[model samples]
Target: MVGCPLTWQRVSINETIAPEDVAFIIPGKTTLAEIVARLGAPDEITSPDGRITYTPFGLRMITRTPQVITASYPGAVARYRFLDFKRFRANFTWGLKFIQPVPGIPDDFVFESGGIGTDEFLVVLDSNWIVRQHAFAKHADASRYRPWPFDLEPPDDNQVVSF
Candidate 1:
């Protein structure tokens, strides 16, 4: 059998998104069309049980009709389970390193891989959509975290925290 030589090249992938670029996407006010316009078409769109989901940078925006009803940003907890210490350690170390330069980054924030892949995010919906809920499988890939515009602020000490 003839042998083939293998070569590899190091490629740098730069994502141009700044936190401010997506800051304008308000949970209740931002429409699906606005999202498509600003972020450019999503990588995927899924409609299940009348709810539409758009995944961009692994960020999920669920909607019904053409308006955005809910937006879910990725978080570390979903990506790092208690049992999966390797991922948990990687995510935690990343978080620590991230906070030093970006002091405003929240403790709950996570670094998620962008582009097309099945990753999850912490889903927080408007009060109106409180009834809708999805359960994660025991072995489901935990939510991958992405930095959102709003999460850039240091949480208020007096604000009641809920996850």
Candidate 2:
């Protein structure tokens, strides 16, 4: 099925389909009319430099499994105690226990910045749209963003250095 409920029966029976393919992918360089045909009217329209942008709400489904557990016993338990009043007391017990579906840390977390799908993608743009001066950032180095206040000069010209 192309989709879950409304099975878009165009290409194949069970083959999965990308959401972008159904929503955005056109045969070739598509125009406004083709866009309206494939995807319905846009939520917001913008025209800048004679280029039109049709921004629509992206579809997504969030799923999560709440932590839980299930346990069972093989048989019942019976305890019996006896005191002889001379040496020792005797006790007996029997039972079985089992636990299933242990919970653990989540495999994937969605909170981190620069996440895969969280970033915006610039679609349908010419070569001139390529960025020349991109904002570069050093991820882990704090000094890259903030220079040291003191003048920490490099070693003298001919000074010997040891590791």
TM-score, cand. 1: 0.26
**Per-residue C-alpha lDDT of model 1 across residues 70-142, encoded as one tens digit per residue:** 5443211111111111111113344354346565764433332322223222223333422122222232233
Q: List the residue pairs that clash in candidate 1.
A: 74-145, 78-142, 78-143, 120-143
Judged by TM-score, which candidate is best? 1
Cα error, candidate 1, residue 160 (Å) = 31
Cα lDDT of all candidates, in order? 0.35, 0.26
For each candidate, what TM-score against the reference?
Answer: 0.26, 0.19
- Per residue, candidate 2 scores C-alpha lDDT tens digits across 9-94 of 11111122234534543323444444446544333222223232222222212346552323332221111111111111111111
lDDT of 2 at 112: 13
Candidate 1 residue spans exceeding 4 A from truth: 1-16, 48-163
